[model samples]
Each structure stands twice: as C-alpha cells, then as structure tokens.
Target chain A: MTARDQVPDGAATVWQRAVRARERADREEQLADKHEAIATETRTELHFRMAYIHRTTAARHRVTADLLEAHAVRTAEWTRRGGPPPLFMTGVAEACDTASVAVTLIDADSNQLAAAASDEPARHAQDLEYALGEGPARDAVAALVPVAASGTALRARWPGYGPAIESLGIGRVVAVPLQVPGDCVGALAVFDPRSATTDITRFVWVADALTRSFILGRDAGDGLLGEIDHRPEVHQAAGMVSVQMGCHVSDALELVKARAFADSRTVGEVARDIVAGLLKLG
Target chain B: MTLQEQELAAVFAQLTGEAARDPLDTQALLAALVESSRRLFGARGAIVQYTPGGAAAIQTDGTDGALQALAADAVGWREGPGHDARTTGCALIDVDVATHPTQVRWPRWSPRVLALGHGRVTALPLFSKDGPAGSLVLFTAPGSLLDERALKLSRSLADIAGHTLSLQREVSESRVLAGQLEHALSSRVVVEQAKGILAARHELTLEAAFARLRRYARSRQRKVADVAREVIEGRIELPTD
Candidate 1:
C-alpha cells in the first residue's frame, strides 16, 4: 500500500479518527513537554535549593518564602498529618495536601521523622511501623526505594489493624524518600480514600527541593537554616578556598564573606571562585 | 428561623459565599450586575459603569440592547484625549435625557453624569485601602419606590462588587508584577553569574568585570546579550575581569 493507504483501515470513523488523532497528538506533545520539564525540574530543583541556601537572607527571603507558603496552600492533602508536624512539616504537609500525595525525608540514621502526613489514617497506619517497629516506609528509606501498598492488600499485611484501616475507608498509600547528598533524612507518605495516588511529580519536586535544603542546613551548623541559604555553595566554595590556601574552613569562610561584605555582595559570590577552581584564596 | 427571615438569611449567606472565591472575574461580574440589578430593582434599564477608580450610570428602555447602546456611547466618550478618571466618575451626558447635572461634591464626575440620565440617582463611593476603586451609581425611574430593603441590598452589592474588583485586580496585578520581578531576578542572576565568572577568570573585581563587559561592548559593537551569552556559555570569557 501507498504511504497514505497504510493508514488504519477501520480504527474509527473519519470524525472519530480526527478527534482521536488530535487527542493523541495533544497527549503526546503534552507528555513530551511534561517529561522534559520533570527531568529539568528534578535536576534544577536541587540546584535551585542549594543556590537558595547560599543566598537566603532577610532581603532575598521574600520570593522563596511566598513560594513555600503558596505551596502549602496549594497542597490540599496534608491537613490530616495530626495536630501538624514540626513547623517545617506544617509547610511540607501543606504541600503534600496540595498535591494529594506523600512527601518524606529521613535523617542520616534511618529514623522516622520530619513527616507531613496529609492523610491522617496513613499517619496512624505509618505509626504502626514506628510503634510496632516495622513498616515499608522505613524499609524504603533503608533500601532507598519507594514503597507502594494497595489499601486492599496492606490491611492483610498488618492483619490486626489492617481491618480497622479498611473500616476507616482509606484506599492507597505511597512513600517517597527525600534523598540528597550523603543523608536520606526522612520519607513523606500520602494516602487517599477514593483515588489511588498519582500525580506524584509535585511530591517528588518537594522532596528534591527539601533534600538538598536539609543537607545544606545540616552542614551550615551555624544555628541557621543553611542549605536553603543559596550561599552554602559559597561555603562549599570556601572549603575549596581552605584547601587552596592551606587555611581552616572557618577562616576561608571569613575571607569570602569579608570580600562579599567589602563589595556589598553575598558570600556565594566569592565562593563561586574556589568551587570553580578558577581562583585561589587570597 | 421564620420562613421569610430564613430565606433572606440564605440569600445573604450565598452572596457571602460567592464573594470568597479568588480571582473573581470582574468582566463577567460587571455583566452580571447589569442583568441582575435591572431585574431585581425593577429599573427601566440599568448600566453599572465600572472603571479602575470610578463608575457611572445610564437609563435604558427596559431592554439589554438599549442598555448596550447607551453603554457603547459612554465608552465612546472615554476615548477622547481629555477624559480622565475624575471626568469618568461625575459625567452624565448620554446616561439620561438632559437632566440638571449635579457637580456638587465630586465635580470631576458629577456634571457629566447628570447630562446622560433623567432620574433620581445616587452614586456611592467604593474604596479599598488604596483610594476609590469604583462606585455604585444606580438610577431610579423618576418617583419609583425606594424601599429600605432594596437600598441596603443595593449598597451591599456595591460593597461586595468593589471588594471583588479590588481583590481580582490585586491578584492579577500582583501576578504580573511578580512575573516581571522573577524575570528581572533571573536576568540579574545571569549578570551576577557573569560577574562571578569574570571575577574568578581574571582575578579582577566584580565592578571591574562589569566595566570590562561595557568596554568590550562599546568597542566591538555587540549587544549586551552577545557578551552575556558569551560569558555564560564560557566562550567569550571576560579576561579583563
């Protein structure tokens, strides 16, 4: 058959075919664009969060803070995380609820913490893992693999309490680890009663953003939320400065921050040099 | 609750509920106000003039098309070069048959509005934190009944409409301005990055980096983007930095 004749013989009527073809094209283009975006955003979210910590201060904090606030409002699922998590988790839970999905981070040691539970029953169910000392979320953290359990089946696995969950009408559960740098601090879990969890791209984005943020905060160790500073890279760059100048990390930081201050710039500006291997510490 | 009171309360509650949704569509709301107020208040015809800081009123022969024509004529007045926010608020030219123009308190808006309509009219100022956002100027057919309930409802509608307009305006304007800010910051980031690279590559100061970029652009006859793209791409690195 000619190339035109090779078209499907009776896939659908002409009108149907056109509609289907248009739909398929739209779907493909949307999928492709979204696919590229998720990939770009996945990488950029980490970089951006790292950049943020190196940069965040009173003046520059407005946009990111507004964004974090909006994200909490946007996430509609986190209300159930029980009396709210720690302050950070409130925002995180807000984000999870907005997306109607799970978000989690585990610290260096495999401990269940820093979780914002959007679906309350899931939090209660998750506590089964913490209280009784067994659950897939913890396992996923240790294995660094996401865990999914169907509501129908999870009840059977937890036998004594699984039936209670079924009674509460909870449907599905999913947990993704907030992994970044050397530490995997916690995992976020989400559940829904009527729908199985999908559209996890948002939660994944949150996890990536917070993971890098958590590490940077931990490393700053200066009684500040470091990793989100966007200047930690400056600090890391300072580490490179210490190595190049044979000085202490603290001295290197002081020098960089001093230069930034002298010029009314941020520490990240000066630290970029040491990290890029282009400038030696003065 | 009594039946009549319950009905009134329910209506109030619904109006309050609808008022809460964000990004309240102002254009859709303007059209809705014209239709519903005309029907609810039994005006011969109504045109609720809406603007950024004020509004006007007009009378029609009990048809939307007549109202539409009157509104169109009013819009035509807006295009002339001299018209301003003040003139928009008080004018009364084509709104009714040549009635005595009342340029009393808000002279800017009052005189023009009287020329347009022939009726007993009231224009209430609508203000948000900023100054007046709009007004609720309704025309009653000469000698029509002005019941207290109807007056309160009309005033309430004006407050609700003005608040909604303010909110929508705030959201959209903020979104646009924020987008602009984000774009500027992103560009600043490029400038900042170029500054960083220049600072590192040439062991020169950041101000020095900027001067080098400016000097190179002046000498070579290239756009700033060409230079920035070069710095960012690592091709035409500013050695002067």
Candidate 2:
C-alpha cells in the first residue's frame, strides 16, 4: 500500500494540523521580521519589543508544529504495528530526554482538573499526587515556578507523595508551571529524568508551548490531541458522596481522596467503585 | 541622530508607551495618534476615523473648534478625503478643497471644509492584515501642501498605529476565547457532579438524573450549569418522583 493509504485517519488529521502549525509559524516569523525592520528604521524601543513578541510567538508555533509532526509519525507507526495507541505526551517526554512525563491541568485554586501522562509510571505518579494532595506538579502550579526534588530531598519535601512515588521506582522529579499572560493554567512534570535533563529552561519552553498551542489556542478544541483525561468518575463520586453524607461537593472530594489513600488504591479505582454504587463513604 | 530623527523617535516612544500602559483603551490610543499627527505634520487639524472589528471611533485634534467639528461630522457624511482613502486603501495627497473636481466629488463636504478655513486635505490609509482599518486626515492652510518627506512620515505613523490596533484586537479575541474555554470546562464538571448528586439522592440512573436536571433548567429558562451548581451546593433541590 502507498504511504498515504497506509496511514490511519487520525494520523492523517494530525499531520494536517502539523502542516498548518508550520505555516502559521512562518507567518509569525515574517511578522517579526517586519517589526524588526520598523524598529531599525525608527530606532524605537516599542517596535523592538513588538519584534521580540512576534519572535517568541513564532518559536512557540514552531515547537508545536514539531511536536504534532512527531505525534503523527508515532501514531502511524503504532497503527501499523498494532499494540497500544501512541500518546501525545510520549513525544513531550522524549523531548525532555526522559521516559515518563505528565501534564496536569489545574483550576484557578490549583486543583487538578485533568491530566495526561506519557506512560504508566507517570500516570500512577499523578494519581498518587491527587490522592495525597501534594507533589511537584501541585507545588510548581501553586508557586508559579519550577519545582525539583531528587533522592532524599524528594521524601523530605513531600512526606506522603515522595515516599509513594519512590515506591513506584521514580527517584527524581521536576515540574514547571504552564503560565499565560495573567493566569497559571497547568504544570508539566518529568519523572526520573536524568541530571542533564534538569535544565529548567527547556522544560519551561515545553510547558509554554503546550499551554499556548495545545491547551488554550486554536488547536484546543481537539482536547490536547484527545489525550487529556478529565477523570469524570472522580467528580461524579464526589457528588454521590456529597449527597449521601449531606456535605459539600468539595468536602466529599477530599473524603474520596482520603478513602483512596487509606485503602492503598488509586483514586480512579475508588472513584469507579463509588460511581458504580459498590462503595460509599462519609 | 538628526533633530528630525530624534523627534520622530520620541513620538513613536510616547505613542507606544502610552498604549502599553492600557492596551485595551483604543480611544486613548486613537486620540493620541491624531494629536501627534496634527503636531508633527503642522496641520490646521487632524482627524482619525478608526473602525477595528466593527467598533468605529472618530478622533479629532485641532486648535480650531469648527474644523474639528466638521471633521467629526464628515465621518457620518462619508464625504472627506479620510473616507475616500479608507474605502480605497490608498493615500490622498494634498487635494485642494476649492478645486473644481474636489467640489464636484464632495459637493457638500468641500464647501464646508473651505468655510472652516482649511484649503488643502491629505489623507493616509491605516492598513491591517485583514484590510483597510481606517484613515488619518490632515487639513492644512490654503496653498500649503505636505511635501514628499512629510507624506512618508505620515504613512509610517499610520502604519504603526494600525499594527498596534490589530495586535490589541488579537489579544482581546484570544482572551475571550480562553475565558470561554475555561467556562465550558468548569460547566461540564459541574454538570457531571450534579448528575451524581441527583442519582444518589433519588436512587435514579445517572442518565435519568441528567434528564431531570435539564428539565428543571429549561423550565426556569436558566443555564444547566447554574442549576447544576445549585444542586451540588444543596441550595436548590429538584423535586423527586
């Protein structure tokens, strides 16, 4: 079969998005050049700042295009091989020189609204953070800065989460806040990354790219390439618990998390039981 | 830098610095633009007719009240060099208001403009990526024309203002889109939570709970998310059975 015919429909669509992103990046670059020309001619600081803004925007679009293209190629290969579907975060993790990465979208209060992970360990690590109510991702988002912990410091920083994630064989972690102009929307967490990969600047660029192009820009309608997991079951369980115990939904959410931690199970497992009417909590 | 270059630099800095302070205040930016144009070009008056994304605004600056008033009214009449330049996306260079062709072209506008003590009009188009954004009109004394150098300076000023306004519009649009996305996500979460609450309270399936929630919201002419929030908060309990 021809390469075009061999590619899956989803991969084809992703490839098309990649092409569009590249075109937009080129346009942004041209705009930056025009602004730079004006700045040079007029010798004004304002035009120079405008040029910088356009250059930064162009860089973000370029990164997004690269990521989308990588995802499309991986997906096409996976379709041919037929095992598990390729994840969008896998390319992100590779960019950071790690095997595991997780992106967590948060509400204004720094509560995680959704999450996507590159692999099972990263997924488990995210769940541990949700159940324990603390982790690098949460800290990075709350403080609006990068958070890093390794070895003993990990356990020292997060008594509950560090020990739990360490048990899953992850020793080092780093996370950066994904910020827009006036808001911090999410965090990107790297698990068991190499020491060389701890360059915070690289992580920041990836976080910004994900926030601008994937989460909140024109491509946001695709829901981060359909990789984001909003964990509806957890919220639903919180609702059921709230009605059963005559408490607020937020309080019920905490109760559900507490139950999951106490039972040594993932939040998703406990939430599924609660939603299925097989479990109840006060 | 030459004296002229230094003055040009200061004007650009001032225009952009003020805009940076309050990017959303398009009126303030337009007013500053016209005032700067009037002073820089040594015109009797300057008028800017800006319509960015359908929100039209007319700003005028001059020592003569009659000429400024006429400039504002000319936008409504669609009869000045500003209107022509805006519609055609081309600059009008030193058109004598008393000329026969100018009078015949704008019969009502040319005579009133002449009576206001202005004899020459020059208009530069403000262009954006989308198309013609607006035009900048400069009125001068009889027999006084803007030289080639002044016309070039006017075009640059108008171009920069147009680019800034376009950037402002893009930022505003993105902000709106981001807000809507956040709202939609939060609303969906609330709706899901409300479904679970109703399901447990009435021993109904989640689907049935959602149906009841929608029914109550539609009946009251309210948003489902609002009704759902109330349900989750225990403020408004839907009827059972």
Best by TM-score: 2
lDDT of 2 by residue, A57-97 (tens): 78877888888899889888987888766677888998787
Residue B178 of model 2: what lDDT? Answer: 61
lDDT of 1 by residue, A1-282 (tens): 133332222212222323433443453344345434533654423223223332332112232233244433423223434342223333455555532333333334553322334345554555344433345567667777676677567766665435544555655666667554333556656555233444665555555554433223222121112111123345345444554565654465567656654554334455665566655656
Clashes of each: 56, 0
Reference-based lDDT, each prediction? 0.45, 0.81
lDDT for model 2: 0.81
My TM-score estimates for the predictions, one after another, are 0.38, 0.83
Q: Which pairs clash in the backbone of model 2?
A: none
lDDT of 2 by residue, B146-229 (tens): 666666666767877777767666555556666675677678789889998999989998889999999999999999999999
